[model samples]
Target: MPVSLWAMEPMMPLADMPAMVLTPARVSQPQSEAPASVTVIDRNLIEASGARELYEVLKLVPGMTAIKVDGNVPTVAYHGTQARDSRRMLVLLDGRSQYQPGLSRVNWNDMPVDIRDVERIEVTRGPAAAAYGANAFTAVVNIITRDPRDISKHTVSVRGGNNGILDGRAAAVGHGDNTAWRASVSRRADDGYDEPFEGETRPDRKRIETLNTEWVWESDSHNTFALQVGGSQSRLERQQESGVADIGRYTREPVQKGERAFLGLEWQHVFSATHQLKISTYGQYNKEVTDFGVCYLDPFTGQQGPGGALLFSQELRELYSQNGGDTAATFAAVPTSGPVLSRYGSLQGVAGVNFCADSELDLQEERYDLEVQDTWQINDRMRLVSGANVRHDRVSSQAYLSGTEDNVSYRLFGNLAVDVLSPLTLNLGGYWERDQINGEHFSPRGGVSWRVAPGHTLRYVYSRAVRTPDIYEDQAITNIQALDMSEPFASNPEALLGWSPSYFFITQSSPGTLKPEKIRSEEIGYYGQFRFLELDVRYFQEELTDLLSHALNPFEFEPNNEGWVKHQGTEAQLTFRPTVNHLLRLTGAHIHTHTNKKTETRIAARDSGSALWAWQLASQWGVSTAYYFANDYNDYRYERADLQIRFRHRAGPAELEWRAVIQHALNKEPIVFEENQYQEDRMWLELEMKI
Candidate 1:
């Protein structure tokens, strides 16, 4: 329960010592012994950054990119591959995967745990599927929260910022002889984007409330049991609007709201000093309530000749399905954006439709996961860590998935680290999975760590991994129907049914016929530790095949494994804390990508980096500054500088603190999307009390 017992404990570099990590190999070892490169962001650095969201803190990692896809949805990616849907990156919150199995995306800001509770973050900057399972393709991010005993008995904090930002948080801790518990709650709300893009209103606002609780019991000296319960409710504003058109533009303002809950249990038994076993089980439930308006054509009453209503969006939806989702003939069968409209005033574009009616996107996703791990210190020269997990996932969605889709998957993984030669360690690991949809898959890794000097190490690694398609990617039938948003339909239509055809049936599906995306990676890395400096650098080359990308059809939403990309790059991160009064951190990445597809390179930032400097003026006064420099990728750049100052004072039995932060965007260029860029400077003020 102490701060020193972090998952990847490096002791915060207080003295001259190499940081030990557990994520790289599932066993605790110093950075000099690990086979891969890793970046550790501790609690001190996280607080010094003055970031309110987890995604904002992720920018300090090398080769890491964080952006918003839909203006409201926060997405973080490593190597900038597919920033819209970072399917290749595996994210974990206290060992539980954060990758959504149904939506095939990660909701960075919708996590149940508040950022204030996080103790540290460990980032493995390459393929780590051997220790983890399938989704650990490009990188692995592990967020570890603080234990109850590490914090005060009670604490409360609130912050208000420019551009409609507000947050309120409270936490309490209690303990008996052998048990310690903590409970925390937070309410976060923000008005997304400072202004509207070109024409569309910036409707990317969000409101969320979360509750997280943890109980750790030392049943005995040999057995420990830990339980965690968490839940969150969020309302994320979503809207889709089109440009100017002769048929009158179409817009769908849908409020995507959802509830997420999870219960996790872990039992750790220490048989002896050298041997230990841990069993973990968790169950999660996610329910999303959302609906959007649709405008469809009455197929029975509308024209149905060879070149009639059949060429509209609804008819083409069925035609594309009946003939397999590979061809674009159906989309071609319709007309492009022009004056001549299709029959029955069908959708003028892919997502456009004339009229509208009510529709609901309601779905429930459930997951049951269980895993057992064993760590054995066989002797002085060898160590073994092995684990296996079984998972069952199911989803029910009438609006998107027609009905229900469920599957059960299993994985077996293990790693062995041995001192093959003095000053050299050989690590070998593998993971094998029997997936319900992706079938049988295997990931393997081999690495060698050579300690050349007292505090210097050189490492070489080769790894192969795969990413299975998600539930929606594997099987989903998404379509909606409405009369029209305008004009004489039925004054007010009834709920959606089988009576009419669909509108804007831009479905994204690939059932029973999709291969998992695979990656072959090789890297040369180095890690060094000194009295006041810690450095990690890596040069990697990756070849990816069978990547999930859009099908040939530009109008429809279908994903297939037809993309190939090769990347050669280098990334480095360094931390320098010469004394207790000053701290400095720097990170940079140079990316060179070779790919024929434009979609693959949409977010590949050629040269990107970040820097942070903090100063402790007095015992109660502190100030920090941060700079984020980005590339001109996608014809847009985000360069920003931030200054944060804080003052702490003693008041009665509680400690009072006041903090302020100001951020100035230097480039003033559009961000991920044209509608998301903010040119003005942002400011925030916070007040906190601890007892």
Candidate 2:
């Protein structure tokens, strides 16, 4: 039977921040209703934007700040917290977690699913750890792909962008009685951008490719079986800003590669009109290898610090020496002869110690889950929906430097919704999850929506969420040079202040003791849409406890349950479709957040906000302009604003697009300047084709 026939109530397609009403009377309703802050990026929108990579399209989404720290190295900031990694947001590709086990970062290159194969992307811009598990403190992104029934033909496309970027995408679908199959593949390559910090420009090359295939079969009765397989590989070569003086004139090195493969199978069975069950299983493998030639600078003549500190200091010394002044070291070259002291002072040698650091990580994971959901209609005036899911995840990771660790995680979740009146609906959801890392949590959520008028809706929500510590948070092992020694031994500037003579110490600790973080949220909002115009507005407040942040002075990050950080914000969006071919969209947000020590009255105040305006002239032409403004809370190094513009045009299956942006658009001089790190303006462009 057709899937649509399975709906006993109206059903709305999953959307981002929408109040769309489903065709009521569907047997199996969506597990959760769309929140007012959710944003849906469908395939149509992806194609219209002419984005060549995930970062380009994701940047427009509210509450997310994306920047290229260096060519080929993109950093993500969500909810005012930025990280060199991109794992804060939970990203799911067809219900499979895209995060590396135990690590709180995401590898964008592994996200190779072609836009052509995507049906829609659902974004929930709030803590979603309750529904999606770890690394969802800020939001959730669910990428739902095209079902076999929705893709019934063969299609192919090719694309090209500035900087030698090239791409090819293809998909094919076929069907036999009661069965359907679809396959898709995408390949993309780009020369990338120049390393930003230094005067020398090095090659920024990147390549990514993916393949996915799916098979679905419907039995004569009420049963269905589906199987899916997907894999991706990427190779990148880029310059490390600090290492720009390593080899000859450029510190550029080839990042050998990163790869991932996944396989999944799902089975659904319906015993009767109001009873159904679903079973899903999947396994994944991922690997990464980086060959950064001289990736870590030797500390003999450089400041003793992490892999990064030594490089920066050496580069500076080189730059000064090249100007014909007294030179200690220069970006041009490292000295061949010098007294070298081991970080621990146990080993001593002359210069040219020749130390090379290589890192490799491998991960394997398997997951199994079962869910049962149904809607029972008591009458036209009343109905109830409920469902429950049980899932188990087993994960293991091995790294050349960090060694290996294994863990198992499990969760049980359910949701309830009821129609209390002709125009009012009430919803409640709860879940219990446990991980081998010693974190177990129970989360509950509740909300209501009322239709006060024919075209207007009002809603309010209050939810509780929890985040289990991540793998990295639980078991990460790394080596760093200690700068501030508070113990009996400490030193800097090649001088006094410690028992140890003239050096930094290597600190090590077990990472599995950190506790979980928890959050409580409260929100109330309203939305309505006129025939041609729509407006949505919302206000929300959230509080977090046991937040974990790393500190070098203390040498170890102890859970700071001693404070509660609060985030309160207002969001508004206006959209208008004057004609079938014209669209105008405006979105803006203002957030006020304060962090305080629970034991003290002191507060850290941060004010951050952003606004975006986009105009779609037609299905083939579009343009967008956006501006962001933020204030510093604790330091001047993190404060700035930016202006951005994007343009897209599609002509005969071909698309052209460009993004011109200026970070620190106001050119506000850094109040506290660090020699190697400073804010600067940049420009980016991309262009694509479909056949």
Candidate 3:
């Protein structure tokens, strides 16, 4: 059936589409409009799906990918670009860049606000480095909270389900003619699925509790001010140890926890009709801790053992010695100025007789940002858009077992846009960004969007982005080696000392000398609407240089010079709405990537490819089922995987959801050299409500 383009349309006029997230100042309008690439995920879409996390919500979006390696720690990829080391997305809460300078990655667990309070998510899926600066390689996520006025209702929600999952949320807003305030809190816990592909997968568990509070004062349309304070604490217990040698080996005790907090203030002013300015400042703090069991050595047998086990064994041995048996000292550390110490010495005080660890990773960050954006209507047929952003940032970290490091950064960025013709917009943006840790860089961006028809648009974009090195990659000094030195020196005690001091490489020494990773990305896409159908398609490719790779061979690994990696992908989405209340969407994607070098000695290739399909349905009554198929990287690196499913049903304001994810669904055995490269299967169920 052929139908008019206006047969199916949103209730609101397109020009008045909510600009709370992708604000009017940033969006590219038709002729005589600002020029930029922006995508807005509305609050309605959020409530309809009842998504619990950002990862699930981003799956349906174009030019983006949210990865759940463990279902708890999420990572995002934008454009056709995959992360080489750190996240390439610059995520902002309101107007403050929520970047952790110490790690060069956002602590997903520490994102202060719950999805419930999000009014809209404005995603610029390209090198916004010119405007956003650091970590804006693949894209930027601008999370805007709801206005306090519209959220006058108080609501509370609670849910529980499989894997010991439990969730609770509460929110309320108070609004006056000139003053408004909002407060919200949300908590979720789950005994997550076991580590897939690893043998004897044990249940990993995580809990996140978040709180956000804000106050806004507005005077007419020219002046507005807001102050926001947000905090979140998430504790994760995975089977892997923080400083352990091999993550795949050994069943470590559950002992990992992470916590974060943030506070921010913002002010906006309009000076006349064509100029506006916004200033924002924010501070954030994060702390993480991990505990591994104690370690010790036996005296008589000269064998390694747990601290508790060794203590018990030593007591028995002492008893035997008192009864005229042989006495032996397991670990005799001769103090320089005192008698020889007979007890074991903890590794840098992280290990002890009890093996209870207090080691922690801590980061504190502060930022001040100022932006001036203006829309100048030069004439009836042409408009000009220009803006400048200045940012100052400080990041500090204290590692419980290691030491401390601090870094400071500053950036100045600007962009210009011109509407060439009616319904056509062209943009050119660029920025000069500098960081204390990575020196300085210049990133440039160009984009064009054309309204080919009444309800159709064609767009092309090219941009350059950057990713900074993290403390973990730049300064983390590991003592663990792939070939256990102890095994080779079991017979001869002095053999271990023969290893050179450079055996365990230290990649970083100077702080401000590391270079930033660079990415060049190009994209073209089309969006069209006809009758009950809407189709969107995009194809993108990203070229990367000076990428960071975790090298299994320490001797060959270096920072910044690991060569290049490439990521390319195709995305397509189709939506069909037979009626106002009945809507269905189908999304498909194909991603292919390759690194300059392989991470393993046995594998000669560092390439991976995957194809995925997702289908969704919606109605007011709320019963929807989705199917997903994923084929793993088809190389010697890892084995392939298969289909997954999710089902959801809503009763009242409460929603019940279920997920069944299978890893290596088709493969039975390990094709790679990795141990226990086998299939992983699990099912999860969840229930949520709103009051």
Candidate 4:
């Protein structure tokens, strides 16, 4: 019988381990000798932590901030919170890009792969454009799944808990001739938080179903081929606002439906012991539909007029005439001066002229990518990796964009690592990229690692990365339903009357093609592994320019790249094993940022830390506990503890396992910034069987 790598006992000696990392330079390298700060979360820790969500797992990593906007939507940030969508970080699942081009956000709930299938997740704490091209601005997360060879049989798992949570998963692995395959299916549903704001409805309920499969074939020892396909469908309840005049209120319940699918293929050839080549291709499709319903009150009647249609009273007509110098003719025309007026008029007509209560936004996007890479071992002391990729993205939307838009991008990157001496290694890498929307740009990175002693290493790294504007940011034609006239306006004759425009249309017209946001970073790091402890520390300073932010005007909210920021931070992680049965880990981070925009850092905490302990109580039983703390960020401050326990036993021909997890065991209500939501403690139980 072969021992599973994931079945290894916890608290292994650091001196006996050689961790391999791939995100730093797009090539496998020793974690101790990597040029940047990298963190690896393996399956053992993942199972022991008993975290159901990917974002929850990230909370344990140093310098990573994971927070739930509600129960279903989570935002993960690496350093500073510049935006809500988390566009600065690049995420990949099994080498396939997970970044959505339309919203520039990773929809964690829509990810096709199940958590149980993930073997490891590698995180790079800083810029990695030299390896991942544009949009790898602040960090990169690479999720690697278990290979088919590692799975010996079929497995099934089920989970149920509070908040109407119900989850189930099934997976199978098999081999035929020279081909190996693995397939998995998962379904999850939750009612989300039960608490509601004063005037807001209960939001964030979500349901997701996914299927994933992969096949690998070895034609010979030197050549290999793999194919992967996956898809997901998700439904989420959203919170929205609706009303007339000054007495607007939130809708009871709004819903969003999303669907995504992807297919990928790869071929690898090993020419010799020192040379290799790989080719990969992938395609992805995504679509989402959201219904935003607003209700208008008749000024004269002082009652709700209709549910889905926007009713423009006489007061609104006069207001539009007073603002734009034209009334019936201009009001009949769409507000923005763009080619999309025809479509807008056809759909909703002029806001004041035509009343459409049920307004819906439809967004669809498709992307195809092809890449080829070569790796050459020039000598025992030197190696080089070069790659080129071409990608095409197309977006079609009615709410945010005027019309269908397509963008094509190309990237070329190379990295070189040379051991100048037995104690010193030098690394250099760069990427050149061209995109239809942002034109062309170049990013470069260089670093040196010095092994000062037998178990200690020091490194210095400098890198440049870029974040390109997303489709929505570059071309948004948003129409917002503001307010309608009420009894107060009707009673006040002096106020503008007879015109009740329930909606305001805002459009952004770029002066020219926008430039990509740029960042230059410098970092120093140290790593040491002693008898019973391992430590890693890094300090970094970054200069960010051409940041994309919103510029508000009376007419519209425009996207402008006019701000700069400076960020400095330190991250450290320590691991201590007092005995083979007990392991302890501590992680902390502190960041200081100066930005031209005040709101850029409003939700970011200045410091955060976590302490985790895992103990193997018996040969078949284990328990873990963790405490997390984050300093005050405006009105938001949090300190929470979590606990988990696992029990395993072998049946006649299968393995049975039972696990329990309790999140926020302290049951404290922490204030959240900029959002009117409540947090609650939750617990879950899971049972698994393997045959």
TM-scores of the candidates in the order shown: 0.89, 0.72, 0.73, 0.87
Best by TM-score: 1
Candidate 1's residue-wise lDDT over 304-369, tens digit each? 122222323444555566546534554453355232233323322223223445556677889899
In model 3, residue pairs whose N, Cα or C atoms come closer than 3 Å (at least 3 residues apart or on different chains), thus clashing, are 28-34, 294-355
Q: What is the C-alpha lDDT profile of model 4 across 1-691, one tens digit per residue?
A: 3222224655457766676799889889887788789988888767656778777788778877777655567778787564355678899998888888987888888888888889899998899998899888899999998899777789999999887789999999999888999999998888776666666556778999999999999999999999999999999987553222222233324588999999999999999999999999999999998765444443223444321122333333334544553334444553553422332233232223212244456789999999999999999999999999999999997556756888999999999999999999999999999988888889999999999998789999999999988877776654443333233433432322222334333233444456788999999999888878889899999998988755432243456788787889899988777677677888999988888876567456788888888887876788888888777444467677889888888889898888898887353443454443556677789989999
Give model 4's clash tally. Answer: 16
In model 3, where do residues sit more than 4 Å from their true spots?
A: 1-39, 79-86, 194-203, 242-254, 296-302, 305-358, 361-392, 398-404, 471-512, 551-557, 599-620, 633-691
TM-score of model 1 vs. true structure? 0.89
Each model's lDDT comes to 0.78, 0.53, 0.54, 0.75
TM-score rank, highest first? 1, 4, 3, 2
Indicate the worst ten consecutive residues by lDDT in candidate 4: 306-315
The top-ranked prediction according to lDDT is 1
Provide the RMSD of all predictions against the true structure, rounded to 1 decimal.
5.2, 10.3, 9.7, 6.3
Model 1 residue pairs with clashes = 355-484, 355-485, 356-484, 356-485
Judge candidate 1 against the unseen true structure and give its global Cα lDDT, from 0 to 1: 0.78
Candidate 2 lDDT (Cα, 0 to 1): 0.53
